[model samples]
Target: MDLAEMIKILDRQLTTEGRTIHVDKAKEHMRIEQRTSGQGVSLSLSELLRRYHEDGEEALNQTILAIDRGLHAMASAPHLKGKESKIFPVIRSASFPDHTSDGRRLITSAHTAETKIFYALDLGDACRLIDDQFLDQEGLDEQSLIELASFNLSALPIKIKKDVVKNNTFYFIHTNDGFDASRILNRKLVSDMQAKAHGDLTVAIPHQDVLIFGDVVNPEGYDILAQMTMKFYTSGTIRITMLPFIIEKGKLEPIFIMANKRPMPGKSKR
Candidate 1:
């Protein structure tokens, strides 16, 4: 197949294998099939074409074949290139039986075989790409890198996050673990959420994550939430994602101010 077609195939396999980036190539390109660059598991277009130019069509065939093997490895193995490892979902559907109504169950994380050395990784760490050299090159420490990941792309918590925001206090939720970033019940917080938190707890953010414990029994308390959310977003500190929601008595109750759509024009009066 042509170089573009070959890339399309590899990318498709990456998607089917549930990888954000199956092949690493330069992001900006001047032309199709032009070789920009490649990193680790990702293949660059020029790199692929070089192979084709050297060996003709057989080069394309061999590369595609290699990609097929990678897809298989991705399914059965935790992709590793030196010290760093890809991250996956931490919890599975079997973890919770009651919330069978498409909550965390909707998340799909890879299953990887683990062999410990200096460090260990699990299928749950899929959302993150942790590399010693990469982090060093970026001029960031592991802790801060992990914290940055936790705040946005990942659900994995590198350490106990920022101070817990109590009722009437302004706080934020963040995680490095990406799969369950929205999930309020973390391994560390499960027992507490189950035994301690009663009604009137809300998780606000740019994303539908990071719980804020507030007293709903207080009049205009929820209004305070809306104001806080708007200020946090508009203050240019964070990017607001989903409309804010609350865990009132252990259930998801969407706030009216966050609603984006109205009822149809033709409907019976309530």
Candidate 2:
């Protein structure tokens, strides 16, 4: 189906459930207003459209249902003052919004030039990004928040699957626990992977649901990783970056991968 048809169906379904939706055809997104709270969320249709094209109607239906559940959870999320343990860091694309629809700045930290770290409160079915207003209301400082989030992130479980492509080994983490990409921030995990690397430990978070680690032993490895990352990035529901990073001395350095040339770590633009 086309984007227009998808949007029409989404609008109808949401409206049928009593949502106040304002469609913006030019921008290809819709604003969903809460009935009682006046707060609203801007729903981007580009990713949904892409999913429809790639995965068909069942995938589209699942995504819409997840959105509905997420919205309901967000609308009724508990106060953050006592939910410190439930807060965790999330890695999002650098292009992700820096502020909420209501203009409250989101709590974020710099990661790489292609990605940013944002904190969110994990409400079972969904997560709500922490904003400036929520921080103030909770009387929590950024450092404390980061500490709590990092601690919680470290505590989460991870299951890795190893794959081989052209004699290079790639480690993948995709638990679908909603924090798969966030696992990149797990220092202990990255350190462990570093010990297992046959060459430079390469990392790629092509989307929110997948984290890739490559053992780059040859120039062809870089080319293979680039192709794999681009494929996942394009087909991902929530894209992070097509560019991959190499862990050097406990730091993430973004790299430029060429087809035949060896991948080189690029200088940070930040």
Candidate 3:
């Protein structure tokens, strides 16, 4: 079927398959964020249908193709930016409340939400949280859904400005006012780093942020990474340093860093 017809068919099939739909016309962009049970699927479907109705199939197709190309490019070049560029994020994930059921946050209450978040996928990382199989069952083929699963965070890209190393840990800094680093990039970077070098390829997204990736093997290395990260904070190099987290079992498990004499260990988690 053509794009418009395909969109219409998909919409009807989505409801028949027992899915809910939501749309945010207030925002100029059409992003398919996280899907819990099934929120983002129809929300995105409706938005894409709306676009097809308004701009016609050709325009919608062009946008899809552009996003696909952008995602392919982002796999290698993380800092890619500027006009004609797209934040080709690859996966939809469930965002969690950072606290207990009472809504008290373990970190900050600012981000505790029962919403969906999207991330660019690195080919190396496995997608969890959402059931891709469900999409395929909803009359959408696997390949097309895979290509379109990513959110177009922005056409303006995020750039990495600088990086430094101390105690063999690499500290990467992305350009300010750009898209925040997603989970997909985090996985690829850490996996690639551990492969190239050694030690646990750890990470932390503090604020908008100062993206820190490193291999902290010993207490001294953690000390150095934490110290410099704090110094950067004092220097205004980054805004806030959220507690760093590690990747395990293809997921981000958050942890707090305590200084000197064997920092509190984040429980071994998946």
Candidate 4:
């Protein structure tokens, strides 16, 4: 099915459940609002359409079910004080909203030029980004929140799958647990990868569900990584960045890759 047909079907499905859907064709997304509470979310159709093309309508239906659960969870999320363990850092595109629709600032920190770190409370099937008002209600300071979130992130299990292309090794973390990219915040993991790298250590979080580590020894490796990252970034439901980073001494510096030239580090914005 095409995007228009998909949007029409989704609109009918959600409206029957009391949502007000506004199609923004220019942006290729639908802004869905809860008619009773005014809480809303922007759902991008690009990735959904891509999924429909690859996995057929059954996969699309499953994704829509997940979206519905996520929306319901957002509308009725719980308090934060006793749920400290569920709080974790999430990696989002730098272009993500910094404030709620009602103007409450979101809790976030600087990461790199292409991405930012935001804190969220995991709600099993979904998560809600922690805002300034939520922090105030919990009486938690930003530093303490970050510390707790980081601790929670580190406590999660690490899983990696290895692949090789033209003698260069690539390690991928794709747990499909919605925090795969957030694992980048786990310092020990990156440090361990760096220690084992035969050459320059490169990292890419092209989306929320994938984290890629490259052991680059030749120029061709950078080219392959660039193509691979672009593919994932374009098809991702929640894209982070197409640009990869060089991890040096615990600092992440974004790099620019040309087809046949050396990758150059871009100036750090954070």
Instruction: Note each model's CA RMSD in angstroms.
Output: 16.5, 3.5, 16.0, 3.5
Q: TM-scores of all models? A: 0.34, 0.90, 0.39, 0.90
Ranking by lDDT: 4, 2, 3, 1
lDDT of 1: 0.39
Top-scoring candidate (lDDT): 4
Q: Which stretches of candidate 2 lie over 4 Å from their true place?
A: 16-18, 35-38, 44-47, 266-270
Top of the candidates by TM-score: 4
The residue-by-residue lDDT of candidate 2 on 1-270, one tens digit each, is 888898888887766354688888888888777777656667778877877787788867866776776678657747877788899999999999998766899999999889999999998778888988888888899999999999999999899999898778899999877899999999999889988777878899998889999887777788888989998887666679999998887788888886455777632211
lDDT of each: 0.39, 0.83, 0.41, 0.86
Q: Which ten residues in a row have the lowest lDDT in candidate 1?
A: 111-120
Report the lDDT tens digits of candidate 3 across residue range 112-196: 1211333223222222122333233345443443344333443334444334344455657555432354433544444655575
For 1-270, candidate 1 gives per-residue lDDT tens digits of 565675675565444423444334455121212112221244557656665665677656655554444334334434334323332322222222212122222222221111001111333422222345434554556455444433432344433343323334333444433333334434344334434434444555432223344434333445666666565433221133333555434543445442322211111111
In Å, residue 148's CA in model 2 sits off its true spot by 0.8
lDDT of 4 by residue, 95-192 (tens): 99999877889999999988999999998888889998889988999999999999999999998999999878999999988899999999999989
Q: CA shift at 249, candidate 1, in angstroms?
A: 5.9
* Clash tally, candidates in order: 24, 0, 4, 0
By TM-score: ranked, best first: 4, 2, 3, 1
> After superposition, which runs of candidate 4 have C-alpha atoms over 4 Å from their true positions?
24-29, 44-51, 54-59, 266-270
